[model samples]
Target chain A: MNYLLDAFAWIADPAHQAGPNGIWARLGEHLGYSVVGVLLACLVAVPAGLWVGHTGRGRGLAVGLASAARALPTLGLVTLLGLLLGIGLVGPMIAFVALALPSILAGTYAGVEAADRVAVDGARAAGMTEWQVLTRVELPLGMPLLIGGIRSAFLQVVATATLAAYVGAGGLGRFLFLGLRTQDYPQMLAASLLVVGLALVADIAFGLLQRFATPAGLRTTR
Target chain B: MRWIGDNLDVIGGHLVSHLLLAVPPIVASFLLALPVGWLAGRVRWLRAPLLSAAGLLYAIPSLPLFVVLPLVIGTGVRDATNIIVALTLYGLALMVPATADALRSVDPRVVDAADALGYGGVRRFLTVELPVAGPTLLAGLRVVAVSTISLVTVGAVLGVPSLGMLFTDGFQRNIMPSILAGIVLTIALALVVDALLVALGRLVLPWTRPAAAAVVAPTQAEVAP
Candidate 1:
């Protein structure tokens, strides 16, 4: 189809591959924002999740909050915050962090909760302190789930990072919104293809991480 | 508040239009996924491939799908049908897996018990597996409902009218109230619809215990913008 060919040709264009507005830069910006946002989310959510999971309290609140959080619209949050936070990266990053937080938090506590109770008991019974039990028994046992949540967060942040262009931030969304406004279907298709490629790569990489990261005995389920 | 008061009609219209774009996909995908999900659950060889396909579909970020679907379907880029169809695909992504899981969770012995009592495959599925799977299926439907309603807002980026119109319109005009109203209304719509779903679930499948329904199943990553 000409549509598909034009999109392929558009990406193949040497001229389109460079400049501040180029595909490579947009991809970099997108990855940069996603990585930073996800890291920020993990830092905040992981500790809190561990606390709740290890202590077994506040689960009711966490579940309610995460579900409510899931209902909030990503674009609505981005636009609202982007305007209020004075455009650029400030607003979108904040919103992205917020959006990514719930899943990571849910994943963390859920993973920790899913830890083998017998192993935890054994760790405690064998003269390990509470902190030692948490670190030695639960954390590694729960790595797959925590990583699952982290990847979910990573994917979410990447999606929001794409929408960053709407707020004067730079990313692959630049191509997307630009093409949308200009009716450049090939350019739009090109951006879509590039994003799909990134998603597949990330998915496979994380799939590998989630698999090998799991302690072999624990890898049977989940 | 005065802005809301002044634009009540417009807000109401957008709300109506938003429901139009959001509801059918939930219904269509729920109905469409049942057979696909049932088959995927029933067949040994199909589950992995079917679910992986769903994962691939869900992995495609929503905006890209919105743009690409028109190309595949020959709809205009801005067509409402594009939003409807996109939302349905997303619903199927979440529903198919949930549906399969739900069906798989049904106790095989209970199904056998039903079979011993003169229930045929169709009758047994209706009498046993579907009822057992009801709560999880409903949980999945609720997830679909919430995410689909929220995702519809993204369509406004391409100039469709919905509550998201308020966000875009508000942002362009630097009107905080409009954006806030949009966000609140969209969330409100989700909650209200979710409540309706809970009621509907109870009405249609009264056998599912409230205790089991208390645990809201974790929704799989819908992979949205």
Candidate 2:
């Protein structure tokens, strides 16, 4: 109870809210890395996943790889990468990208696979090129799921970004680290609250994006 | 034969410590998560916010949390203290989504049917909604347990005595065998925790098997075909 009060006090303090201590700057830097990581995952995973889903031959391999990716403990992966990259955001960044890929890949696969079969046949009957059929029909239908994958990857990257702080990548985790070292409960609470708050705000925004992407029928059903 | 005698104590100690570190946090997180999740489900506006909150909580980096926690509660692991708090935060991710989705996914028709049958709101939720939602909720618990097992390694990195400590100790001392031992033991611990959760699911919620295992497990037909 007392600890909670102290935490609130620290968050409320005018001094702590200033300049570098501004919540957005700390969270913004963290989000920047997360965006980069997810963008990189999407760049590769989306196209590869799209092709795999379109043909259905390489899907087994794709799914296998995604599961293998999940099987890896993120910390273990990061530590292993750390050995090669040297302790910094780079190692953690690679691990985060790896973490984001499986979801994006899977989501993209499902999205494209779920495209209406008739539409594709109709496009073929109309003499559309394979690429045209995909671009005009498959990718459009796949957008919601693809966006879902992006959202999932983004949330994951955001959460995992905290881990980067371990190897000296700066973020809200610094306050968390400091609180632990100094036994400053208020500071720790404040930092944790901030991180959680940041994540919640991001998720709500993502949910809105999902709703927007959702087809009208589904939105009403939901 | 020589290796057995030389490392028996170290191996045994780590085994006990690892279980001690991992189990309580998972159990505590479940206890904290259930009611909160149920409450969030009852209120329509609350669901997204609650889930988002949980997701964010789950995203927290464990190492920083470990370092920051000592300042908040004045350190040292008590059954009611620092470790449980950390574990609770970690579990929040799995718990919130699992619980919320379970509740949300309860077929809307079922809830409507209960209302038509003259069941009160609370009764409808408890008798009708909760049962159908059982499998999904359990699935969430299972995810939390596995993730918690992995995240517990953060404790060792922070100088907490556990299997993670063994890993850290072995790493620092450059003792290859011990590091290998820690990795093996931690994997064993995670696997065991996961297996136990699966067993619990089968026992408590039989229908949950389809929802949980189907995604992660290969169908027999897929394999045999």
Candidate 3:
């Protein structure tokens, strides 16, 4: 359509690519927020999920918490936090981390829990300590699903980090918001394309990562 | 509590709008996804593309979708129609794959038995395959319902009337009580809906519940090992 072509023209324009407001710079800010937020969520969630999976306690609690967390509206959370924290990067970052946590936690827990019980018993019977079994046996076997969780989390953070714009933290969302206000349809379309494109690229890259990270023995012939 | 009491009528109105916006999309998507899912399940080659498309749709963030939907669909920026359309897409994204997987999971033996009993393709699918796959289908529906209910709140960002309006109003006024009320109400709504779906699933598929409990007993012992 002509509109898509116009949007492509906007993307191709040198003027839009060179300034502080350039797409590249906005992308960097967006990635910066997303990377930091996902890392923070992983730091907190992965370990907690692994512990719960390893101990086989609090599975219900973890699931309950994750589900409840998933149901919280992200925009509302970001804006509410912004109101309390004065609309800085902090509020959006908190929202991003919160958004990513549930997926990662649920994925990790499900992956570890779903590991073959026979293999886990074998490791323990081989005189391996609990920690050693977890590190050596369970972790590698569960790597695929753990990566799957991370992949979903990463994509979610990248997608949702656009809300950073709402709090005055610059990201790809700035284009869409500004375009909306100015009634610039092409610009809005272009920004959406970028977000969709970024999400697809991340998803494909993670899909590949999951394949590589999966142990050869565990790989099923689909 | 006091703030909610004072704004009871406003909250009530928005809640009705929220349900109106969410429920139709869910029902519509389920109906639309049924045939698509059957096709995906029946045709091996179509499975990858169909599921990948759903995944791609799911990866799109709600905010961008909200902002750009008007351009894609020719709706007004602030129209409730935009929210309905976006939410319908989301429901389809989730339910399509779920339906495909559920149908694929139907016991082939049962289908064969139905065929042996002189049931036609459509009749077998409706009576046997669907009933056999009921639990998984219901589980997927429960997830979609809860997610749709939560996501309806995001439409508040564009000022479509929903419980999300409470969030916006509370934020603009810097009223924590109002914001908390919105958050609590949304979560409570999700929980209640989720519980209702679970009960509905049990009522509709009484056979699956006993089988589910039987499977759980062994899993508990496996947990210790």
Candidate 4:
């Protein structure tokens, strides 16, 4: 009970909430890496996912990639890349992109799969170009799941970005590492609470975004 | 290569410990999740709250979970049981959802038919629902096994010996080989375990061999040439 109070005290401490090493600053760095990582992953995974979903080719590859990505240890990957690329945000960012890609890709293609097949067939028969079929028919129908993919990707990257501290970048993980070294259970607890709180906020926010983004007609159909 | 050869004994020990640390959590979490997942699958109202609660477990970073869980569970920070408990929670996060989906994917009529045949609650689930849920459950197991194996390394920071120690050592000491070995070994372990699960699935779930395996099994009479 005392430890819990101390953790909250540490978080609420105005002294601890300012300057470069402050809680807000660390949170910024963590969110920055996470947001950038998911966006970068979207660039590569989204296009490939759309092509695979529309063409129905390489479906197996996408599924395999996502599962394989899920199995990798985030810590090992961050350190491995840190050694290879030299320690900084760049290395962790790359790892996050790799980690987030497969989930997003799978979500993207699965969304397209979830769309009404008859509508897709009609779009094709109506002489729409391949791109038109994808954009007009698939994109709108598949947007929800695609966003869902982004949500998962965002969640994953945010959590894994904590390892960014290990690689000598700034994030909430610094507090975790710092707390452990100093035996400051309060600091460690505070950091953990922050990370979890960040995740919950992100998850709920994404849940709302996913809800609102869905075409209202399709919402009832599901 | 020489670095790897020189460190083989150390690496081998970590590998064994890694396996030891990983397998139990995967097994325990699967067992623990079955009832909860089954309940969620059967009861419509419970599904969201149960799954969302399970997912909250995943949001807790392994690093912090490793450090702080000892507080709640009454164990030393470095205890293997500590990591085991933490990893099991992680496994439950993934497994419950997977298990629920696995059960939900089965044909409702098969369950009804089992009830119609005088099978009681436990018997119906064990004989009828369990077999049909096998392929998807096994699929979930594969992911759980792979991820759990890799996650075992995170315990190294707290001084639990495993392949993750190599990562910690390599990072602090600038020993490139050690880090490489950890990454390679973790990935290799994950892949090998995943393949074993797939093979185990094939051996145990023969009904799943056919294209219509989901609807096959005891209801084989319904499948036509």
Candidate 5:
């Protein structure tokens, strides 16, 4: 009880705040980098997932890569990548992409795989090319799932980005690591609270996105 | 040939570290979640709060949680309390969902039948509810097990000598063989553990397979017998 209370006190103390501006400013910089990383991961994984799922041709290979990527721990992957890329944001960037890929691929695959096959077949029968069938029928049907994958990837990047602090990439993890080193309970608790809060917010945002992105007819079954 | 022959002991040590790092948390999470999940089902008011707390705990970043834990307690790789606490939080999130799902998966008709027969409270639960829910519970346990094994790597980020340590050491040294070995071993461990969970689930909850399938097979056929 005392430990939890003391940690909260430390965070609340004006004197304990880092930098001249406050924690929020520090947060803004970290969020910038982390969001950029997540965006890059989305750009890669979502497209790759769409291709794999929409085509149904590379699913096994995609699943294998995704599972392998997920199995690779962030610390090891980031640190190793850091060794190759020489630290900074690039290492964590790659690691988060690897972390987010499986979920994205799974979501994308499950989404398109679940699409009504008859509609797609009908489109093809009605003089639509395979490409036209995909764009006009399959892709729209798969939008909610594709968006869901993006949402999961976004949350993953947000939470895991804290590890970037280990390599001096700077994020909420900085506060967490610093607090541990200094035995500053408040800072550690504060950082943890912020990260958890951010995750909850993201989850809520994703819930809203799901409602909006999904066609109303589809939402009922889901 | 010389390199492979000479460093056999170190490689063996790495393998041991990897196994040790992976197993404990899984064993612990399953044992711990069963009772908590059971308690949650028994106590209606406790379910929501406990689940929410578990979710919050689950969202914590692994590295940060490990680093912070040592400050609350003392530091050491063998600091079982810290490792257990850190992992308990992680496993708790999965377990709550798993347990709730397991319980929810139980056929309400089974529960009603038990009640209709005058098998009340603990008697009904021991013989009917829990037995019926067993497969669902084991399914949850499987998820918890897989998750625990993977996240145990978090312990390595704190410099605990485990499989994750091997990965970290190799990464620091830029040794591909060692790094690859760690990754491969961890995946192998996860696969083996998951397979074992499946086998255990099948053995313990034999009825679940048919029951689960039956639930979705045209409710009209199930007309209140």
Candidate 6:
């Protein structure tokens, strides 16, 4: 308890808040990397997943890829990339993007696949083009799952982004590694708390986003 | 390849430690989750809280958990016990919900039939509900097995002497072969374990063998990270 209080006190201290190594700067770096990583993942995964789901040609392959990707250890990947690329933000970013990809891709593919077949048939019967049916109908209906995927991806990236510190990049994990090195248990606890706190906040915010972005009918049916 | 051949004994030792660190937690958590999951499935009030707790546990990042396990468990920083206990907690977090869902997925008609045939609650659960739920339970186990295998490497960061040591040592020495070897071995271990579990599931639940492909499709979605 005292350790926790001391950790909180350390975080509250203005000096820790204002310096180059302060919480704000580190938090910014963490968020920046996570956002970029997730965006890159989304850019690649969503389109690929959507195409695969729409075409129904590679669903099995997509799922297999996601599973294999998920099984790769993030820490190992980060270090491996760091070794190859010579330790910088790029290594961790690449790792984070890889980590984020599977969930989003799975979600997009599953969501689209789970869309109402009847509605899709109806859209086609009404003479909408394949692309039109996908973009306007399937994507809209699949929004909930897509958002779910994004939410999972966001949480994963943020949590795993702490590994940035391990690869000589700056993030909340600095406090964790630094605390471990210096035997500053309080700092370690504080950083862990920050990571957990950030994850929870992102989860809640995305939950709301999922609720809002999902169509009214779909929400009630689900 | 030469480096791997040379370090075969060392890598084998690490693999043993990794299995030691991983397998017990998975087995223990599965055993523990059985009763909790049964309770959650049977009792409406317990389900939400139980699943919520599991979700919270699952959400915790692995690195922080590994670092903090010693403080939480009163173990030495370098103790493998810390990793074991931490992984057990994680295993429980994953398995609890899976167990609950598996039990819930059992067809209610079979339960009703068992009850109608005058079997008591315990007998019905053991003979009917459990057998019916076995396939889904096995599916859940497959996810847990793969997940636990992957996560065991994370403990290497804290010096728990798993194959992850390869990563740490490789990074320190800038040795790509060792790092690649570790990654390959770790992933291969996961795949092998997953395959074994799938085969075991087939052997135990012959009725489910035909639908094994269908059963595995949704298992990927349940993978939380």
How do these models rank on DockQ, best leading? 1, 4, 3, 6, 5, 2
Q: Give all candidate RMSDs, comma-separated.
A: 6.9, 6.8, 4.8, 3.2, 6.0, 6.2
> Each model's C-alpha lDDT?
0.88, 0.71, 0.84, 0.87, 0.70, 0.84
| Cα lDDT, model 5, residue B163 | 63
How much does candidate 2 score in TM-score? 0.70
Give the per-residue lDDT digits (tens) of candidate 3, residues A1-222.
Answer: 677798899999999877799999998888788788889999998899899889989899989887787678776787788888886788888888888898889888888887899999999999999999888888888888899888888887876677657656788988877887788878988887888788778888888998998888888743
Encode model 4's per-residue lDDT on B113-224: one tens digit a residue: 9988999999988988888999999988887898889889888877899899999998888888898889888999998888888888878897667655656554766554
Q: Write the per-residue lDDT of candidate 1 for residues B1-225, one digit (tens) a residue.
A: 999999999999999999999999999999999999998998989999999888877766777778778778898878999899989998999999999999999988998899889999899888788888999999999999999999899888889899989988988889999999999999999999999999999888876757545453332223332
Runs off by more than 4 Å, candidate 1: A220-222, B209-225
Name model 2 segments beyond 4 Å from true: A1-29, A58-71, A116-128, A170-175, A178-194, A215-221, B1-12, B25-80, B89-138, B170-184, B200-225
List chain A TM-scores, every candidate, in order: 0.96, 0.89, 0.96, 0.96, 0.87, 0.97
- TM-scores of the candidates in the order shown: 0.95, 0.70, 0.92, 0.92, 0.76, 0.93
Cα lDDT, model 6, residue A6: 87
Q: Model 6, range A130-217, lDDT digits (tens) per residue?
A: 9998998889888889998888888778767876687798889999889877878888878878887777777778878888988888
Model 4 DockQ reads: 0.59
Q: How would you class the docking of model 1?
A: medium
Docking class of 3: acceptable
Interface RMSD of 4: 1.5
> DockQ for all models, in order?
0.59, 0.18, 0.48, 0.59, 0.27, 0.47
DockQ of 3: 0.48
Which of the two candidates, 5 or 6, achieves a greater lDDT against the reference?
A: 6
Candidate with better lDDT, 2 vs 3: 3
- Top model by lDDT, which number? 1
Question: How would you encode candidate 1's per-residue C-alpha lDDT over A1-222 as one tens digit per residue?
Answer: 678899899999989999888888889988898889989988899999999999989999989878988789888999999789877888998988998899899989998999989998999889999999888889998888999888878877777777667777888888988898999988988887787777767777887898898997865754
| Candidate 6 residue pairs in clash (backbone atoms < 3 Å) | none
Lowest-scoring 10 consecutive residues by lDDT in candidate 1 chain B? B216-225
